[model samples]
Target: MFELIKKKLKHTDGYPYLLSILEHCLQMTYKRNGSQLQQWQLLDRILQQIVLQDEKGEDPDVTALENFNVKNIIKM
Candidate 1:
C-alpha cells in the first residue's frame, strides 16, 4: 500500500487524495503500535526526510535520506 503511495507522492498532481490517505494512515500509526502493520520501512522512509531536515536545519532533503535509517522507527 505504502509502496504505491511512495510512488504516487512523486506525482501527486495525478492522485488528488494521496496526501489525505497518507495523513489518515499516519494518524492510525500514531494511535496504535506501528510495528505490526508492515509499515516500518514506509514510515521509516517517509519520516527520514523530516528528521534529516530537522537535524540539519534545512528543508526536507530526500537526497540526504536515501540511505538513512532510524534505529527505532516505532518510537519516533
Candidate 2:
C-alpha cells in the first residue's frame, strides 16, 4: 500500500483517480481505529517527502484506483 502511494506521489501526473485515493485515505482516518489500519515507516516518510516537495510548488504523488487491488481487506 505504501509502495503504491509512494509510486503515485512520485508520478501521478495529476490524475483525478489517483488524487481521490489520498482523499479516501484521509477520510478513512476518521473511522474508529482507522488511523491504525495500516502503517508503514516508508509510507510515513514518503508522505512527508511529498508534502515537502509540494511546498516547493510541485505536484506530489497521486494514486490511481487500479493501484489499489484490495482483497478481503476489512476496515477497522
Candidate 3:
C-alpha cells in the first residue's frame, strides 16, 4: 500500500489530490489499528514523502503541513 502511494505521489500533479489520499490512508490506518504507534510511524513515512515532494516544488498543499506530527494534527 505504501509503495503504491509512493508511486502515486511521484506522478501526482495537484497537492489537493495527494492530501486527500493521505487523509484517506490515515483514516484507514486508524480504523484498522485505532491510532497505534505503528500508525503514526506510517503517517511519518507518508509525511516524509509529502515533505520531499513539497521541497521539490511539486505539491504546494503539502507545504501547509510540512512540519506536521501525528500528535499535533490527529486526535486519537
Candidate 4:
C-alpha cells in the first residue's frame, strides 16, 4: 500500500490525498458496521417479539425505519 501510494505520487501530476482516503475508508467502515449492528438489533427485537407473541399477542411491524436518508448519510 505504501509502495502503491509512492508510485501514484510519482506518476501523477498532483498527489492524491492519502489521509483523505484513509479517513473516508475509516468513516465508511464505521458507518457500515453501525448499520449492520442496527440491523442485528432490529432482527433480535423481531425475534423477541415472535418468542413473546404467545404471552403478549403482539405483532411486529414489517416496515423499516423511515427517517434514515441515504443521501444525507453519504454526505457525511
Cand. 3 TM to true fold? 0.28
Best first by TM-score, ranked:
4, 3, 2, 1
Clash pairs detected, candidate 2: 8-61, 9-61, 18-63
Candidate 3 steric clashes: 0
Q: Write down the lDDT that model 4 would get.
A: 0.54
Model 4 alpha-carbon drift over 4 Å, by segment:
1-33, 59-76
Cα lDDT of model 3 by residue, 17-76, tens digit: 777867876676344555555566666767676667754568645554567676754566
Model 1's TM-score against the true structure: 0.24
> What is the lDDT of every predicted structure here?
0.60, 0.53, 0.64, 0.54
Better of 2 and 3 by TM-score: 3
Screening candidate 3 with a backbone cut-off below 3 angstroms (N, C-alpha, C), the clashing residue pairs are none
Superior candidate under lDDT, 1 versus 4: 1
| Residue lDDT tens for model 2, 19-74 | 67677667644344543444433345456656756556764544422344333233
Clashing pairs in 4: none
Give the per-residue Cα lDDT of candidate 3 at 57: 62
Q: Rank the candidates by lDDT, best first.
A: 3, 1, 4, 2
